[model samples]
Structures are given as C-alpha cells and as structure tokens.
Target: MTAPEPTTDGTYRDRIIAVEPGGNEFIADADRHGRPSQLVWTWASPNLEFATIFLGVLAVAYYGMNFWQAAAGILLGAGLGVLAHGVLSARGPRHGVPQMVLGRLPFGFKGNAVPSTLMSITAGVGWFATNSVSGAFALSTLFGIGPLPALVVVVLIQTSLAFFGHNLVQAFERFAFPVLAVIFALASVAILGKSDLGAPAFEDGVGGLGGFLLTVGTTFGYVAGWAPYAADFSRYLPKTVSPVRTGFFAATGLFLACTTLAIVGAASVTIATDATDNPTDAFTSSLPEWLASATLLAIAIGAIAANAINVYSGAMAFVTTGIKLPAHIARALATVFFGVAGFLIAWWALADAAASYEAFLLLIAYWIGPWLGVVFADQYLRRGHRVEGFLYDRSYTNWPGLASFLIGLVVSVLLFCNQERFVGFVVRAVPELGDITFFVGFVLAAGCYLVFCRAKIEAERVAL
Candidate 1:
C-alpha cells in the first residue's frame, strides 16, 4: 500500500487524506468549520488500548509494587479513570478526531499546546525512561550484563522497534499479550499458596482510606494519558464496534488485572520471602523458569511488547509537539532517549524506597487532575456532548477549560509540595488526602470550568 505523503510540511499531518460532506458532522477542513474529517488511523486502531490498559496496571504491579498491592492500587487508582474513559473514547468514532484536536474545542488552539506537550513529556521522557529501565533490569538480571550495558541494550531495542512503527508493533503484541497472560497467571497461582490465610482484605497492613485512595489514584493516573488518546485507535474502527462494549471490556479488564497483579505481588512477598524490589526475579527464582533457559526469553518478549507501545505513543506525542520530522525518525529518537534514561534511573533505587515511590507516584498523579478534569468538564458542560467544529477557531476557545486547567495544575503542584499552608494542613490532618489527589484535581477542574461555562452561556443568551 502507498503510504500517504506529506503535503507541504515534513510531518504526516502535513496532508489530509479524506473528507465526507453532509454525512461528515465532524470538524475537519481548515477551509470549512465544524465538519468532521477522518484522521488516518495510520497506526492500527485505538483497539490497541487493550495493551495500554494491561501495561498500565502491570507497570505498578511488576516494577514498584507486589501482586497484592498491585490489586489494591489498580482498583483504587483506575476506577475514576475508567469512568472518564467512557466520555473520551465514545466520541472518537463519532467525529473521527484525535484527542488533542478534539481538545482544542475546550482548551483553545494555543491552550491545547499544554496537553500535547504534557503528554509528550509525561509519556515521552517519563514513560520511555520507565519502560527502558524495566527492560534493562530484566536483561541485567537474566544475563551477566551490568545495569549500564543492559541499559544500552534496552535503548538499542526500543530504537529499533520505533523504526518499524505500526505494523511490527501490532505483530509484537499478538505474541506478547498471550505469553504475558500465561506467565502472569502461572506466577499468580503459584504464589496463591502464600495467601492461603483467607479471603482478601483491603488492608495489607498498609491499610487506611488514605493509602487506598492514593494507590488507586496513582494507579489510574499513570495511564490517564490513555483518556486523551483512547479513541485514537477507535476512530479507525467503524462506529459499529459499539463504544460501550469497548469501553466496558477495556475498563473491566484493566481493573481486574491490576487487582490480580497486586494480590499476586503481596502474596509473593509472603511466599517467596522476597524483599527484592523488582518482582520479576521473585517469579523466576520461585518458578522452575529461573534455572531453565526460558527466563531471559520471557522477560525480553514482555519488555519488547510493552516498550514498543511506550515508544510508539511517545513518538506520536513528540511529533505532535512539532519535531518537524517523519514519524519513524521522531519515534526513533524518543525510544532511544527513554531507553537510556530508564536504564540509568534504575541505579537510583538499590533498596526498597517505598516512601520515595509513594512520593513519586503522588507527584505524577497531580498532572492527571487538571488534564482529566478539563477533558471531563469540556465534554460534559461546555459542549453538551456535541462535537465542536472549527476546533482551531479562536471563537471556539473555551476559556473555562483554560482557566480551570491552569488553576487545577497550579493547585495540584502546590498540594503535592505540602509546603503550601492550607494544603499542607489538609494533607497532615487527613492521612488519606494523598490517595485522593486525583479527586481534588478533577473536582476543582470540573467545578470551576462548569461554573464559568454556565456563566458564559447566560451571557450569550442575554446578548441575544
């Protein structure tokens, strides 16, 4: 198939592929306002969210947390994120717009830059670094290679994968997802013997409403990036696919998987007697696989499947932020950068830095507050669930969204720092405040934006 050529700019976005009139209700043509256009679902469809959801939970569970806590973290963290996903993903197939473009209706064309760039930094350097680091750890543990050498290997692998982009990524997933399930299930059940104590408890003795809330918020917050891009894959899929079906399945799968992984991690702590930070080694040492040759292969494949998506998504964000390069070249740079960064960061944690991990996840979760809240408020209040056209139009600039997001972002940063007087008092008084930061951020964004949007509507009505 002939790949679509760029029109004037070097970016694939440099050109338009197709437009349907009358039938097209979405905003697409720069020449025409409010009419929708189909984006080249060039990267496979948003259905790839299956991988996104899976990996999001697996990350916290496998890397920083154990199986039991993975369970708690996923359930608590992802619940709100899942609720928000419904609104975000459903509109994609209807209008055929990418999340960032759709965002312009709410954030304004200029304001939209914040999210596009935020996604890039969070997913780009942050996510890339994380996946690359995991791969490095796997390689170092499985082989005799040092962490730095393993880090180099990780960077090379991610860069190579990014070079292939969509097709190879798709193939990698088909194989990786199934293998991961089998391995996770085996390990989970194997460790179940440790928790023969009884039915599950909300308290791992890490207990409290505060910790639970924080764990849940952080868990879902990590992948809150998906909310903006959920429909990025679904847009290519015919509207017939049923948004409700996709959303439910994906959300449920994510929630359950995280719960399972957390349970397994906590269980492993007791069974394998592993105080080790990385949970992968616990599985290998306990299972027959460690002594066998397949350990390296399993770790490598899992890392590749996930790191591929991380790099791919990061590349998309980088391109969106104006890299002025072909998709392949852009993706290559992100993959390598993250790969090397992740490897090196791994060295920073030699012991169980549980306090540090909590602090980091909480800090990261702060971004989710403004982004998700603004998105939610944008779709529900300002637009009335109606897809806005001329999304790039200055008139379409929903100041409510802009103000709300900025205000929310600033508040979240302050609260996260704990030096701010009122916020500090709140966090100090309420042990559970850390767990619910997403709620604070989301509520602030939504409440503020909704009030402003309502006032704007009233002003327009009076003018008429």
Candidate 2:
C-alpha cells in the first residue's frame, strides 16, 4: 500500500475524508499525517460527557465523600490513570497499528486473541451499554420519552460514526469539543456556585478512609478504561511526531476532562439530594429550564461521542482477534452487531443506573488492571523498539503474558476485590482495605511478566 501524498501544509485531507479500507493493517507513512495536538481534543471531547460527570457524583453520593475529598480523589486517581494512557498512546505513531494488534508482541499472535476478545466485549458491549443508558436517560428526561426508543436513537448515531471509522471519529470529536466544553463549563459554574465546599466529610454513614480508597479505585478505573484504546486514535499522527508531545497532549486531555467533570459531579451532590440514584435528573434539576434542557441535549451528544470510540475500538479488537473478512466489512458488521447488543444491555441497566454504573466501573478495573500490567511490562522490556515483524506473525505463542494476566486477574479478584456481588477473602476479613484489586493486579501481573517473560521477549526482539 502506497502512502497518500501530503498536502503543502503537511495535512493530508484524503486521510480524513476517505474511509479507511485496511483492517488492522499498519498505516502507510503517507497515510500517517496529523498534528499531535489533535489528540488533545480527540481524547478530551468524548470524556467531557455525562458518564465522567456521573463518576464524580458517584464519589460524593455513593461513597459519601465531601466535595473537597472527592476532588482530591479524582485529581490523584485520574492523574495516575491518564499518565499510563499517555504513555501507551505514544506507541501508536511508532507502530502504525491498532492498540490490540500490538499486544501480539507480548502475548504472541494467537495468544493476543485472549485480551483482544475481552477488550472487544468490554468496549463494544460493556462500556457502550453503560454510556448509552446515560444518554437514553438524558433523552427520556428532556423529551418525556421512554428510554428504549431513546437508546435506539443513541445506538444508531454512535454506530454510524464507528462504521465510517477513524477520520470521521476524529472529526466528530474535534467538532464536538468546543460546544461540549462551553456547555459543561456553564453547568460546572452553576454547580460550584451552589455547592457547600465545607460540608462535613462523612454524611449518612459514608466517608471513611475505606470509602476514600474506593472512590480512588473507581475514578482510576473510569479514566484508565481508555488505556487499551490509547493508540487507536494516535496511530494516524505522522511518524515523526514526538512521542513525548503526543503522550503529553493525550494525557492532558484525559486528565483535564475527567477531573473537571468529576469535580462538577461531586459538587453537584452537595446541593442536590439523592443525585446518585438518577444522575441526569439530579444534575439538571438545579439549573434553569433553558440551561437544563441544553445540558440534557449536550449529555446525549456526549454519550454519542464517547461511544463512537468504544464501538470503533471494539470493532478493531474484534478484527484483531483473527477475524477473516474485508476490514471495512468486518468493522461495519461489528458496529451493527455490538450496537444492538449494547442497546439491549442499556435498556436493562436503566432500571438501576447507580448500582449498575458502580459495578461496571469496578468490573472494568478488575480486568483492565491486569491487562495494563502485562502491556506496560512488555513495552518497558522492549524499550522503544518497533515490532513490525511481529504484527502478523501468528506462529509465535507467548504463554507467559497469558499466564501472568490470568494469574493477576484471578488472584486480585479472589483477595482484594470488594464489590456488591462477592467480597474478596481479604476484603471480607479486613473491611478497611477497600477495593485494591486494581493495584494488586497491576503489580502482580507486571512482576510476573517481568520475571518470566522479559528474557524471552528480548530474545525474540534480537532474532527479529
């Protein structure tokens, strides 16, 4: 495949207007053309939506944290999460492949299927449903419509965006950024003006050190969930783009968007009672009718923005797992199939948005923590090396990555997890530790992979 010729200004319009044809293929050098700074809006705009705001709300209302405490947790957790996200994003331009495709370097081509399959379900079905429910609820509130129909509307719009693929996704996000930023900014001002920042840290049996830890874990999970898809958007940047600059922009966008909105959500809780139960209503109830209506509309739009990434990356993950078909056809089919599935899940989740959302965020942490551990360890072991040769080499099967991931997942869930469904043994035995599963999983998986797989990975690199 020949790279498209660059315009005099160094921007390639064909890359943006053209529907990307290849599936999980390395981007040609000519096709790789865009400013690294575009990642700022590309990462930020979608996250500017309600799901992120709801996380802040979850911190205050559900975990019983006060505004200041919630803000602290959000800042710290989101800061750490986005740093990892930024580092991973730098890999995109260097490798010119989807994030999951690069997993083959660590997990082996066939073994990479394990994480790719899991990511497909998580992004396409799990997160898609989660955000769609929030959007549907916003529509229902704004129009007095039922959630099912609203969900259908949401699914159709986001799925279409994913069907068109990369350039459109980036364009849509860039277009949405300024509007979303202004609307959410207005909402934040209104919320902060009404909030009681000095409100007692613990109210109604909430806000202990344990609750604080839980809030941190939830916030980290919410932001870090984007880590697996980090490179998907960044791969289109020109190969010469500075990795540091690219990572900085991506991280800044994620950190700013998630932390700012989360703080808004937290502050909103101080003045709005029972906000956690129905976040859309709680958030909009305090605003004037016109602004409230506008905010609701923005939320629905935001869900579409977030889900565009989810569906697109999810489709990419599906294709990476050895699916055989034309890339465009596979992506289109995956978008439709997952859209329907997500709609059904969203419809069901609307019944208990607060509980369902909380569980979803924590569950995301459960798997993603271990996955990040393995991926980051592999990246470190490679030390800025490229892996073009390993991209399509299916014969290699790196059992170590798989074993490390499973071990970390199982051990972390069994011990440190503290959730609604089942408490881990350690958490049950000592309720004060909170949910430290993500931390435990990351450390364990990374340590295991380093000990067992690093030498083998280095040997393969030398052979290449």
Candidate 3:
C-alpha cells in the first residue's frame, strides 16, 4: 500500500526505513523519540495502480459506447485520482506516517476511528469479495467450471499471497509487468488490425446533460479508494523530493496507465460480446496461441497483488484505530477476518455482481470521494505545509476535525447513498445525487473544525 524512508540519521531504532526511486532516503519515524528505523523503501515501481481499475475493455461493454466516450470518461476519473493522490501522498512523507495516522490530525484520536474502521472493513471485505468473484469468473471462462469452484480457488490464492505482505506483492508486480505489457500489446495490435475504429462518437446518443454527468459520476464513484493512500506511499520519501515530481511519478503514472487500460477494456467489450462479465476475458481473446493459460495466471496473480495491498492497508487502518494490538498482529487478524466475511458476501450477494458492478462502484464513490476530499483539503490547506507532533499529541484532541470528519461521513452515506439505495441486490447502488454530496462533506468537516477552534478561543478568553 505504501513505502517508508530508510533510516540513516542514526536516530531512533523504531523508524520505518524506505528508499525512493531516485535513491532518496526516508525514515518513517517522525517522532524519533525512542524507536529505531522501522522505515524502509522495501520495493519499487508500485505497478500502475489507482488508475488501472478503469482500463479494462470489458467495462466498455456496459455503455456500449465508442472508444472516444469511454476514453473521456476514464480520463475524467483518472484526473480526479491523480490530483487527489499527488497532493495527499506528498504530505504523508514529510509527516513520516501513514494516511490514517495523518487522518488522526483532522479526525482526532477517537474521531479517526470511524473512517479507519470503515476503510479497513471495505478494503478487507469488499476488495476480497470483488477480486474473488472476478478471478473465479475469469477461470470459469477457461475451465468451463461452475462459479463456486472458481471463487474458492481465487480465495485460496488471495489468502496465500496476503500472508507475505507488500514484499511478495511488489515482487510479483515487477515480475509480471512485462508479461502484462506483452499480452496487452499483442492484443492491441490484433484488435487494431481486425477493425478500424474510424471515428468515435463522443456525445452521440448521450442525448443530454443527464447522460454526461452519469458517465462522469460513475467513473468518480469507482476511483474513490485509490485516493486515500496518497500519504501511505508518500510518507517514505525524503522530505526534500519536490512535491511536483512525487505527484507526477506516482499519481500521473497511475492515472495514465489506468485510462489506457480502461480504453482497452472498453474496446474489448465493444468488439466482442463474448467478453465475460470479468475483464480477464479480454486478455484471453488476444493471448498468443502458444500461451493461452498464461493469461488466466496473470489475472489470478494480478488479483492477488492488488488484494495483498488492500489487505495490508486495511489492516493498518483498523489496527491504528483499535490502538491496542501491535501492527503485526493487527494486520494478521484483520486480514483473515475481512477475508472470510468478504468471501461470504461474495457467496451470497455477489452472485450477480458482474452484470451490475457499476452500481456497486458508484456506492463506493459515494463514500470514498467525500472522504478523500475532506482528508486532502485538511492536510494541504489547513496544515500549512508542515506536520508536527501536535497532530498526534493527546492534549490537542482536535475536536473540530473529529466532528467534521464524522458529519461528512454521515452526509455522504445517508444523503448521497441511502437517499436512493446504498447497496443494490447485486452491487452497491448510486441513484444520482449530484455533485453537491461530494463538496458537502469537505465543507462540513472544515466548517465544524473552524467553529470548534473559535469556540475554544472564546472559552479560554472568558475563563481568563
């Protein structure tokens, strides 16, 4: 989910050590009061994440639109993620802490509990269920087996990879990146040769404003989670790395890759109705004859790599909130617990998700988008470019942050999601609440914090 700065200052033994791409050193022990280097730059090339979610040609099938419209929708989504992640990740490295830890500054000690627990639950259960279903569905495309067996296989693979944490996940990514490229490249070539896209219809059949906003809203809804980890990865960089470069390398790379992949997936679906509800079918269609099974393996591995990060991040969030368990144990228990729950969810509610995955994606957006908005705005605008001990100090309490975070979460869930239907029978639902819900959370959190800070000033004056 993130990186840590390598501890070289000979300070605390408790720092999280991490190395950056340009050989930058980072020590994730901001409070080098006692701990040594727990910080580490354990791995590299974080594998075009945050953006890749939108890139599968299989997604294109839902709208059945031409390449241009799909590309536009993906681009809009990528822009939102890239901007959010770029600013947010840079802040975490300077603070030498994870995003959720940083979140404590705005949400207060107990206030952060809700967001952290929610995120942990979602990442653990939601990601596991979705990935399990996708992987199983992919295998079904090849083996002609029923969906149940595929789900079991996917769960087993996910559980195994999660045991190793980010080390194995990053290594798998590095190992598999080339294969993904080769297969995708080959498929692109074949697809291009077979059909001339001619000119794509962007606004065609969109009819009016409703269709346009719907498309934008859908993409934004799915991309909500990727924004939260900006700090998780950025917290490892040397305090000196230009935020511009950090944002570009990490956020831009993720977004660009995602948009490209989504276009390809959309293209795949537009071209072939044989496309499975899962996008891996896109790969199988273009894999060279000699390497048929390799496609399936890559998807399985890809799912594992993704879910590994998800499990790790979710565990960190949950443990931080619980504030009792050590990181290792917290990660372990949360990983298993969420995995099991998510598997059950998949077994029942997710049986038909492939057909209505977009709806669920929108519900995620309802929650994740507003949360990201509040966190990112608070870190950059309110913190004034410095993260200090006061953020974690017990005395400060951050009542405003706590109040605002809670209020915003409630608004997004109750107003944006439940107003229609939060979770449909197949997937989470989004019945089009408009953009106001997104901004409302940020404004409410910020406003509440300002009010609380002002009230505290008044109370102290009156006492004096």
Highest lDDT: which candidate?
A: 2
Clashing pairs in 2: none
Q: Residue 52, candidate 2: how far off, in angstroms?
A: 0.5
At residue 274, what lDDT does model 2 achieve?
Answer: 55
- Could you give candidate 3's per-residue lDDT for residues 395-422 as a string of tens digits? 4455665566667767655654422344
Model 1 quality (TM-score): 0.73
Task: Assess the local accuracy of residue 248 in candidate 2 as a C-alpha lDDT between 0 and 100.
Answer: 95
Q: For each candidate, what TM-score against the reference? A: 0.73, 0.95, 0.75
> What are the lDDT figures for the candidates, one per model?
0.52, 0.86, 0.54
Locate the minimum summed-lDDT window of 10 residues in model 2: 1-10
**Model 3 misplaced regions, further than 4 Å:** 1-60, 63-65, 143-146, 192-207, 238-240, 274-279, 282-292, 391-396, 409-464
Q: What digit string (tens of lDDT, one per residue) describes model 1 on residues 253-312?
A: 444444455445445444434656553454455656543225444555555555565555
Worst 10 residues of 1 by lDDT: 33-42
User: How close to the true structure is residue 343 of candidate 2, measured as C-alpha lDDT?
Assistant: 82
Q: Which stretches of candidate 2 lie over 4 Å from their true place?
A: 1-18, 273-277, 384-386
* Better model by TM-score: candidate 1 vs candidate 3: 3
Ranking by lDDT: 2, 3, 1
